[model samples]
Target: MTHRTTTGTAAPESGAAVPAVSRTDLPGGIRVLTERVPGVRSVALGIWIAIGSRDENPDQAGAAHYLEHLLFKGTGRRTATGIAEEMDAVGGELNAFTAKEHTCYYAHVLDEDMPMALDVLADVVTNAELAHTDVELERGVVLEEIAMRDDDPEDLLGELFDETLFDEHPLGLPIVGSEESIRGMSRDTLFDFWRGEYTTPRMVVAAAGNLDHAHVADLAAKALTDAASRFPTGVPVGPRSGASGLLRPRRALALRSDDSEQSHLMLGVPGLNRHDPRRTVLSVLNSALGGGLSSRLFQEVRERRGLAYQVYSSHASYADAGTLSVYAGCAPERLGEVVGVVRDVLAGVAADGLTEAEVVRAKGSMRGGLVLGMEDTASRMNRLGRSELDHGRQRSVAESLERIDAVTPEQVSALAAELLDVPLTAAVVGPYDDESELPGALQDLA
Candidate 1:
């Protein structure tokens, strides 16, 4: 179950690996990405498993996240504490996280400790001793995680948006499962999931910092040589085709006093997905609208009117569904005005689109940003791995550059019209006593 290694053209043609654009394949399909930094003595290695919250079934909502915790508990040769001892002994730090679509385990270590780091990661992932006691202990940790998200209004808003957007689908479920579902998780359950999905070919062991590709692959092979299995042959599922909608726009406002500076408001609309052809144009469109400080929303709302300290608009594209979002922080009294200003900006942009100069600057910022960011090993690994997950084989940086460069003002305008026209679902947490205006605000979208 190994794949052919591919190196994107983002790296310098010479031996110097520009950040992580250089991709090299190793035996067993262990991929390599690198960022060659001058005077640096270490490299950051990431063994990214192409599995995450979205991969969970109806009964295994939190299995991916739960498995992430257990991977560090113990392996065939080292205890959880011992794993730490070894990394600490070598001045290396290790950690992992489970995201909506993938789970990543990473380590930053000096040049000499690469072998040991690889071993520790491999033992934990391949030979985890997922004991019942470890599973029970970690279950509490995950529950705390769930509680934390529930307490934050902004977080809850996103959760609601997803639930509403994908009403009857898994795409809308939270990354961490519900309390009851998390409690139902077991060791055998995670093991079964891991065995089925965590095949050698479906994963990438990316190393940057200070290391060689051949050596890393050799170590990875030893650690994961036995991990050969046929990838599940399920038919590809298509994107959501039903009428896109969100949760009931109810007045759910919760304000608790805790010496806070400003309230955070998370407003969202249905967004596009990764496979959409309009993605490149949307990137530039989002940039001009609310991507950074110099955007239209910031200029109109903050600079001109001084309504809020922060305001931005952006989109999150996925494999099936997406969400275009607006985030802001402001005084309780100014929330209404801020909401109005955001709506006006969206309406204006959708109708008139951005200026030629605005489009140029946005694309320039995006182009320069992409060129500059790919100068690291971890970044290269992430780009290649992520694009591969979405578009299959790694695409050249030149291809990405051309795509972003080809975005026209008309394209951006059309996307804004489509996305902004969707219903606006918002979640506000602050001193918002007057709930009568929310309906008007929601109707103001587009």
Candidate 2:
């Protein structure tokens, strides 16, 4: 069986069938979202928390990510080694990640092992010991992580792009804070941040596999019973609502001299937010622009001219704002030619838009991506958690596919014009000693 919309009710936007999804708000304000998929013996469970890097203040910086590491270090009942051994004994995989807007601690295990997964997840998330020695040890690890990122040209360029594009906004900060920030982060500071942010209202537990919704709900409820009083009123905190103040877009050029063999560049403009109706159209537009080998940017910059070895287009959408960008990694000497070709392709698309054939191909690719992504329990669990957290409602797969099918060429063109007509921001990381050495096209873009 496929996934469902949720328990409260199915809000099917299309006549096609949908999975029997269930959502329950527990007595302590925890949200349980479950989808039962047949023929899958393994279950994927994730506890999604709304606190992420964007939720932190300047001083708090990487506290959210720090907590992710510390939680796995040890809990009240399980030492770090014990936690690892238990998961290994069950042959289950437990992992977690921190993002700009959320953090997730997830596990992939057999259906029968669901009890152990829930217990361990609840203990680590709610009752972590965050000992001082572990804090100091993990601090060194996070610093090495930051250092590793610094050594990667592409990763560094992306961080630089965000810093330049978003300016002072918290969204601009990297998921792993800087060396200075990580070095200064104290154990007490992280402990306090964890206590304040890890609330019932800010959390959601999601599972998908061959499991019953009511049973999963009960397991999660019992696992989290000790923390119930933390939410005395049992009032759901609801989705994040308010102005993110990310509207201010700083259009400029940023250069980070890496003395690398190739120049990595991203030229982009502000795009749509998560809730924008035209986001679907933007997806189609992105595909046609540079999403695949058949895309315009790839064809013009890599296929025909062979100006760059790699060239593509991508975009990111946050709650408040987003970005659409084209990336090209080429020889430093060929940087000018690469930038010119990419710019020309973008300008051409903005002026004339994509052909009907291109739009059709993009839509098909998008539809395939949507359907193929749900072939596993882990992906389905992620979809359930993210949809409930982001939109406050689960959109059915059929309905989503229908929306993609309905995106007309006119819709794509309009969105392209709206997003591409603005002044662009460019970020380059490579062997450039001074800004004057940049290509004329890149300088003009700047």
Question: Tell me, what's the RMSD of every candidate?
Answer: 4.9, 2.8
lDDT of 2 by residue, 272-316 (tens): 888787889999999999988898898899899998888899988
- Global lDDT scores for all candidate models: 0.70, 0.87
Candidate number achieving the greatest TM-score relative to the actual structure: 2
Every model's TM-score = 0.83, 0.96
- Residue 4, model 2: lDDT of 23
Residue 335 error, candidate 2, Å:
0.8
Model 1, 214: alpha-carbon shift in Å?
2.3
Candidate 2: where is the Cα deviation over 4 Å?
Answer: 1-8, 12-17, 242-245, 248-250
Tell me model 2's lDDT, rounded to 2 decimals.
0.87
